[model samples]
Target: MKKKLGLTSKIFIGILLGAILGLILKGMPDSTFKNTILLNGILKVMGSGFITAIKMLVVPLVFVSLVCGSSSMGDVKKLGRIGIKTLCFYLITTAVAITLALGIGKLINPGIGLDMSSLITQKPTIGESKSLVDIVLGMIPANPIQSLASGEMLQIIVFSLLLGIAISMVGKKAEPIKNLFESANEICMKMVSIIMLLAPYGVFALITNTFATTGFDAIFSLLKYMFAVSLTLVLQAFVVYASMVKLSTGLKLKPFFKKFASVAAVTFSTASSNAALPLTIESMEEIGVDNSVASFTLPLGATINMDGTAIMQGVACIFISQLYGIDLGINALLTIILTATLASVGTAGVPGVGMITLSMVLTSVGLPLEGIGLIMGVDRLLDMARTTVNVMGDCACTLVVSNSEGEFNKDMYYGKDCNNLNKLSESELNKDMHQDEDCNNLNELVD
Candidate 1:
């Protein structure tokens, strides 16, 4: 008998089928479809459950993996160089993103020549902004258990890194705990794979539910805004990242993009930079980045990098201003960039944080926060694309930094063997070790 379709393929089919069904049902009268309780309930349950499972793994995965990666480094100071480079790249790229968004939004004026009476308002619960001292102190985690319980991923990451580094410093004395963490890391990866098995069902539900409720009208209404946002995102991905690749590593742009395209698509579809972290690291390694650098920088970038978010804020600020007929001055534009960049750091890794941060940006520029509702209807659809861009930015930074530090494989980067290079680096590491062991055994026999 022919083999059944795999999980991913199955999910893809489901998604396509769901889209068609949803569109069909959307055109039907309410009384005709309102009684289909079973279908609706199943979709809701499966879709929400899948998202929950994905979210459930995010915190532990980030904490355990960061600890495992950081602790294995064997030196804390080396992280400083990586940290500096990573932060500098993230911040600079974010500024550029916002600038691009702002410039483009102004030119396109997507919100202009449109009425606003129909837009719905969505008020987000705003968190208190802590002082720099408090933020830094919070990083130390007064109680790690509490941090984990609260799902404070950044705090958990910080605590894990510190604990991991301390373990490394303790040397052989900390072997048991170190080994335990290593085992935990492996288990988490297994969990990730298991969860991924449900991806197709989850994605189908997500996309179907979205399209079923949201007809193509919203897209039509926001076409200009979406177009502007997408154009800037693509330009930044190609122009900014490609330029950095050439400047830092002397690598050819075509091959670099070809290697990164698939991973970029995954990120764009998922929208969670953290979710895309594994793929990003794998791709970097396949392209010849050292494990040490890729492992450390990529995770950190997933947490703090906001080039895409920055761009959204920039465009949104301008878009909102045009809607309200307010002209943003030089100072106001500068303020939007500053606030958006900072807000990106503190924003939690959850759905709708982008809108929250965008609200913050609007407030900084004296734009009406209520104007946020104008775009909220279409925000979810745009988020996936922006997120994909965000993940791409993170990976690009990692590649550039790795290249600069001489940690990238120049041959793999320049070669046409991109297909074979797609294997996860961890597997390659295991193969090398097995070969080394065989060689050592032969040498011992000779002696």
Candidate 2:
């Protein structure tokens, strides 16, 4: 008998093979077979289908899991505390990412002595950043169903939080409803598992499509910008997030990254946090973070937490400023930090949103709006790395909050007795439940 390959191994393999295939396609001459059959026909269909499959689960999973996590507490005040901690961690880390990007941009000088004639020929359409007032009011949805239909994540989170609190306030009267939400949450997770079965194929197709059209010419020209952005993202994930997990939860970092590898690959391929939400939550359970915290924080984090995007914007802003020989003052850098932080939270979690928010950051410091075109050529490649960091930020916050609230399962984190939980007798489970309030995860353990 042969041992089975895990999902993580398969996904990475897909990425590797996909990149090779994509490069081969890029090298080939332009032909109907390449464009009509290969690029648009198979790869596009499979990749888009898989993304649609995963995104289909995000709304239901967030709504159900959030309600389950929120109502499980039975205390609105605990929910409030979790909210504060989650937001603070998200916002603070985002600011740190921005500052780091600025430092990195200066060190690398990605745009010093660059030619902007070809790139900045036409002004890119700059999307307007929403005012803080508008973003605040928008969370209160006039029609939550419309928001869900449109996949408005922040709106969905607000509605879910309200529904959860109402469910908790009713107490015994809401028990049946709470049970229904819990069951629904389980079913949604099962759906996620089902969709993830096709992840490797989907990931392969997605990567293939990207590299097939992305020729090496643009890459050669903007390689420095690409290197700078990539370095910033790497630091954000390994240095900042590693320190955060160690400091916050006192957990070893190896197991955390190892468990999260497959999700990171998928997130890198998909490049949308909402599209990756299903896998992110599933991975959180494997990392020993409770569904309560994972459920609440991950969904909200996907919406407002844009640490990864902030890094991209910061680096791009600096790169652009240098392209036009604009010297940024210390006050301008401070403005970039504050503006990018707010813009990140206000921006949606869709793919390419970083570009939209980067416009805001650039405008704050009087840089050319058209400077965005300078880096657009390689944004697709860099986008994958940054999205992975955003997903990590979400998970890190979940771990820290879960550990602080005593909702985390250390035994699960250490890979001890994970399978044995299912073997325990009812009395054994009851005994453990008394010792740790987080045994609900044990009750729901599949293995």
Return the top candidate by lDDT.
2
lDDT of 1 by residue, 1-447 (tens): 999985545655766766676676567676534425523577667666765565566556656765765566554355878767887898788888888899999888887765442322333222234544654565577888998887554466567667877987888899999899889877877776687677666656655554565555424536788888888988888898878877877777777678778887887676678777788888888888899988887776776677888888888877766655666776666666666664455233455456545644664445665454346445666788888888778778888888888787877777756565656576798899999999999999999
- Residue 167 miss distance in model 1 (angstroms): 18
Off by over 4 Å in 1: 1-78, 115-221, 416-447
Each prediction's whole-model lDDT (CA): 0.69, 0.74
lDDT of 2 by residue, 106-206 (tens): 99887775544342324432223555466557657899999888755556666876787788888999999999988887676667667767867877786
User: Which predicted model would earn the best TM-score?
Assistant: 2
* Clash count list over all predictions: 0, 0
Model 1, position 272: C-alpha lDDT score: 77
TM-score of 1: 0.57
